[model samples]
Target: MSQSQLVELDEAAVLGHAGQALAHVYFPTDCLISLLTHRVQPRSFEVGQLGYEGMLGAAAALGVSASAFDAVVTGAGRAWQIELPHLRALTRASRSLTLLMTRFLYFELSQMGALAACAHFHTLEQRLARFLLMSVDRLRVADLKITHEALSLILGVRRASVTLAAGAFQEQGWIQYSRGHMLVLSRAGLLQVVCACYRQDLSTYDQVMLGSTAAQ
Candidate 1:
């Protein structure tokens, strides 16, 4: 814990470059980080998100030494970061830590798989709702300090798509959108709009990492 430093994540700041060394592990308190892929042309899309309930570098903790995607801060908030060497040292001294991280990596893979399907099959409106719900789950606020441009970038869609979808959401009274931010007005409404992917992801993480953290 002494080695951990809490820092504010600037939105869109790149934490991990693809194929680069995984130098640190991040434990989010209120921050949100997204795993992004830029392998395709034109834009990058999110593969998964990590927040207070999750940690970055679960793959590295499982012995993967490099990142496969770019890890970017999607929301500006504070998280505790510990250098990778320290994390490896901790694992060497603790069996429980190793098990806990292994379980987390399994849980992380499930999220990635679900998101892959969601991205490929779900409508933009449904996917946007799911993303909103996921972001709100880790923060203490109902308002998302983001813009349509950011959403378009995160979802790998055109900004016009985000604008049209957001308009529909605003018209339905599920959210309030302004110059560069959004406030969710109805949690139940957003839930109704989102797919089952959001709920499954949360449930799996809770089951896999909850209480198991105490063991670590």
Candidate 2:
């Protein structure tokens, strides 16, 4: 704890790339980190995300230094950071911390699987709803400072698609958007729009990580 430091992350800050060696791990306090795929040119998509509930660079605890995806700060805020070597040493010295990391890894895998299915089976509207709700949950803010262009890249869709869906959401009184800012008007309305994957992912996290902690 003494070795860790708090740092502010700027929006769209690239932390690490796929196959790159990680220098530090970050536990977000009020930020969102996205793990994106490596595609040709400017084409890439978010596979998973981390916020106050999770940490970046979990692979370090498993004796892995290379990153599996490109990590970027999508939401700007503060985070507690620890260098990779210090993290490795701490995990070696702490059995409980190691156990926790293993559990978190499991939860991440479960989320990735759920996301894959959700992408294939769910409609764009449902996916957008889930994304917005998840962001609200992580940032703990209803007013999101994001734009349709960014959403297109993150959700791997066309900007027009995001605009259409966002417009519909606005018309339904679930949210309000203008000039890149989106204010969630009714979470209950979004809850009705989102797919089952949203709740399933949360349930997996509670069972795999939170439930384990309670048991101990």
RMSD of 2: 1.2
- How far does residue 65 in candidate 1 sit from its true spot (Å)? 1.2
In candidate 1, stretches whose alpha carbon ends up further than 4 angstroms from where it belongs are 211-216
Q: For residue 120, give model 1's deviation from the true position in Å.
A: 1.0
Alpha-carbon deviation at 29 in model 1, angstroms: 0.8
True-structure lDDT of candidate 1: 0.87
Q: lDDT (0-100) at residue 111 of candidate 2?
A: 83
lDDT per model vs. reference? 0.87, 0.88
- TM-scores for all candidates: the values are 0.94, 0.96
Q: Which lDDT tens digits does candidate 2 get at residues 14-133?
A: 899898898899999999998877745766777787889999988775688688888888888999999889888999999998999999988887887788778788999999999899
Best by lDDT: 2
lDDT per residue as tens, model 1, 77-149: 9999999888888887898788878898889888889998899999998899999999998876789889898
